[model samples]
Target: MTFRSPFAIPRQLLTGTTSLGGRSAISTRLRCNQRGLATVVPPVTQDATGSKGPTAMVFMNMGGPSTTDEVEDFLSRLFADGDLIPLGRLQSYLGPLIARRRTSKIQKQYADIGGGSPIRKWSEYQCAEMCKLLDKMSPETAPHKPYVAFRYAAPLTETMYEQLFADGFGKGKGGRAVAFTQYPQYSCSTTGSSLNELWKWRNRLEGKRANGGSEPAGTIQWSVIDRWPSHSGLVEAFAQNIEAQLKTYPEEKRDEVVLLFSAHSLPMSVVNRGDPYPAEVAATVHAVMQRLRFKNPYRLCWQSQVGPSAWLGAQTSDTVQEYVKRGQTDLILVPIAFTSDHIETLYELDQEVIHEANNPGVKRAESLNGNPVFIQALADIAHDHLQKGELCSRQMTLRCQGCTSERCLGQKKFFAGQEQASMVI
Candidate 1:
């Protein structure tokens, strides 16, 4: 059962395609590229003996609860993170209090959207499709097996690591593992936290081995997909999806339609500390707008600001109301920061903000969940890492440089070492 806005207008009206003669934005944009979308990708060659052991691509993200009962637990775990809350000594005491207070309200919101977040389902599907694409792209390497590791919920990062070790992943023998951060934009709080948990598990395993525990299979050489906010395949996916949504609007009003790009908000405190999230999110919007050739006037906004310590702004809901006040009735919301449909897109944007705005034209574009182009983008990233034998992007050989954030810096150095070791072999 899916949850759609009860106040949502008819399909045609919502799409802005009345009986008025108007060309669908999708048809107009995609007419030339009907065969397949063009993307900037590195050449993939069929080279055997790339790596010896099985290749594991583990996708990591901030997970949601699978059921209503898990809501409080999810919130508690999320709030308990010092990276997210940053309450220091007060966090252990206040995290549970905050989660307890917010649980019921958040639970109701989740119920409004079919009783749970569909993030895991969509994430798993994306991973599965990416595996297929990776196999096709790099026939020389062992077929990639996809795994999901959530930071704060079931199938947690530790659980996934244990499973991989049990299955002989990372047990040397030339086994290669890729920790792909699902967050296209890098942030100290999100990707940083997930990777830290992952390495902690690795260190624990080494400790066990040192203490006379039986050594498992071979050691696994690990790489990472740190950030790809503006990868060509990813940009194409967003542009195509936005154009498709725009086709629903009346052709005459399409030129005046406003594209509102909303991303999850981080506290200004985080930004003051030099967290790169806001800048990276803006880069994504800039890239997508460039891809669309700036067809529509757009604004980048923030959503889901929690715990109210002066998060990023102007807030999405307030922006919607302000646009209406300015006689801008035709608006389309693009969740630029989020890759899949979840509470932020489903409830916060769809149900609360749009519903409260009371404007029929203020509709939302769907998230890029399991889009084939996006899957290809992910596969391309992994294939590049495997071929180069380094954790890097097409944009850079080392994406994080001169970085003060300990986790980000450490991970980059670790991958740089891996690249050096590969050269020695």
Candidate 2:
């Protein structure tokens, strides 16, 4: 599948700069414009006495459409991502066709969920709030700027990269930026694809020197918070939400209410590739269960498996149906993997599964959207990463056991080597 940029660059931005792989020259200009453009665009960094920041905290995720009108484009982009869907050699040909075919159905789903996904609203609010807390928690990284890089919607990775350049990041005046994945657990199809796209843009916009040396001096240095499946703050947030949901049950039946932790399912193809998602997701469930002291019976189930391919399951919908049929109708579904409300939770879980079960006792736990605890956890994670000064988690340096993609290898190497690169400067 091919990821084509939906936004175009003005001709002026392409004046005098190198292009990578004959792609475009605009990206290079965005970096090297320091020579003449620095005068017009003031740097975002602080003066000698202030905090060492204006740090960019970019949140990455697989975004959904914000409105019904955007559903088609969103699905088209999603289906076109080989990293996420992997449609083989005809990926380019089949992706758009499949997207067009499914657009109407998906659009209706989004319409039923209040005309669109609340992901963008929640994501923006969460990131902005997290940045506010970071400014107080980590003075060294104060003036934290929040940027959302959505894989399949508006404010795409390319757009975010351009904004960074426009905001005085990489025009030869080096600064720091952190790519924080919104997903609690890492998966090649999700976090990995986002990082790969980020890496691609970094190379295009901040490519090697015209003389074929290293990257230009003062280009933005990057670090990553790749994954944090079982962070204490995260577990606490989930446990609290589950407890609150449980309180709704009758006093006598509270303990009998089943806690079903649901995460997006992966294609078995991906799972067999040794993707770390399933295991990490389970880690999060275990951590939250321990925090709750396992007061209620619980199980992990997968949801949102698209297409006909074999997917990892105990499919959430099926599980809910079976349990309710067996008279275990007091089930509280916890969207464990998603950070905010989207079509999956709003439409699938709420509108479809629970609605079909036709039982008022069957309900869903609240998402982490705008949850103070979850937002605090975000700040804590960022603060720790900034203080530790690691390029990325040690786990990020390793690839899946069955991986063979050159893109994955290169992306890993670039991020993993940032420690030495940052040190050299």
Candidate 3:
């Protein structure tokens, strides 16, 4: 959760930088020892001018452990975040104790999924695929280099930024940077935390450079894709995934299969503070349901509740039990919030939740892991946003009126400022 380094280094450190090659050098200099992950050195490809394109696409999300030994560290880092646990000034003191207490249980869960989460692999693949798709679908940004940064694990945000800065990011020659949150729905605890961490790091580098330090001085044009809960392409992807999963049941039983949309739960304390996560989640579910022309019974439930605090619910387990009691045993549980297959989807839904259900007919939809349709949807969303060069379409950019978190509010103002800057130019 914490790293120590000065904000600036020598100008020679960044001279003659290229995309994948620059990253390999930075990784070597840092001596990255993350779960055997080496720098992904991409082959050189350039435009007609023989120069890499100016645009870079960065994807941000919560990272998972690649092995059993890292489970404790991942959870500890997650709990240590004040945005997640809200332990006030005592977070530093109590977070470690809490993580240690839960390690054994969480480790067991990770073991069920091959001793670690495959999230890193899946995310990296998604990044690589997106790079190819964007080049083909949005050639204006061709020669795009992709980077993935995690909030709680390796390939940490600061290191990814160092690679970008090395490649002349935020420098005029680099052209532009577009950051897209992998979380479909926005939450102060997740995407907000990642963005805040990024800016904090970027600011430190910039402040030091402004005072005649070594960080790159020319600023890159930056944009963000903050939230897209109801994006048409995304909605269609979910609808298609759910419909495909439901077809596994017999035709007659299919009508009886309840569509259970489940998302990771948030503490009510965060909700009462006007985080807007719950509402955004609902928006995604509603949009997906509408896309399916869903007439069958459906309900939104929460999963992955940790610690004994009130969480956003109708918990997924309790709901299944209640449905079983009512003799509605047929079900299709869709992980509406998650895009990748991780512990929450693989272990929680497949094993723990299913074990609690008395209905043998209950089934779950697979997470959208490397689905070509879904990946194309992601590409389409980014292509459109980049073409317009806006944070989002005005409709897609709407915020929760009740959200009062400074981070959420700041995102709104930041995008508005970008639009105004465009006007002045």
Highest lDDT, which number?
2
CA deviation > 4 Å runs, candidate 3:
1-39, 43-52, 168-173, 208-216, 391-425
Per-residue error at 175 for model 2, in Å?
A: 0.7
What TM-score, over all chains together, does every model reach? 0.81, 0.87, 0.82
**Residue 242 accuracy (lDDT) in model 1:** 91
What order do candidates take by lDDT, descending?
2, 1, 3
Misplaced by over 4 Å in model 2 are: 1-43, 46-51, 209-213, 418-425
In candidate 2, what are the lDDT values of residues 382-407, reduced to their tens digit? 99999998888878877898999888
Better of 2 and 3 by TM-score: 2
Model 1 worst lDDT window (10 residues)? 23-32
Candidate 3 pairs with clashing backbones: 170-219, 170-220
Over 140-252, each residue of candidate 1 has an lDDT whose tens digit, in order, gives 66666667888776667766665566555554533667889999998878887787667666666543233333334455566778788889988999999999989999898
- lDDT for model 3: 0.69
Q: Rate the local accuracy (lDDT) of all candidates.
A: 0.70, 0.80, 0.69
lDDT of 3 by residue, 121-230 (tens): 77777766777888988776776777778877667777777777665565334356777889988887887778777666666554423332233545555577877888
The candidate with the higher TM-score, 1 or 2, is 2
- Tell me how far the alpha carbon of residue 363 in candidate 2 is from the true structure, in angstroms, after superposition: 0.5
Residue 280 displacement in candidate 2 (angstroms): 0.2
Ranking by TM-score: 2, 3, 1
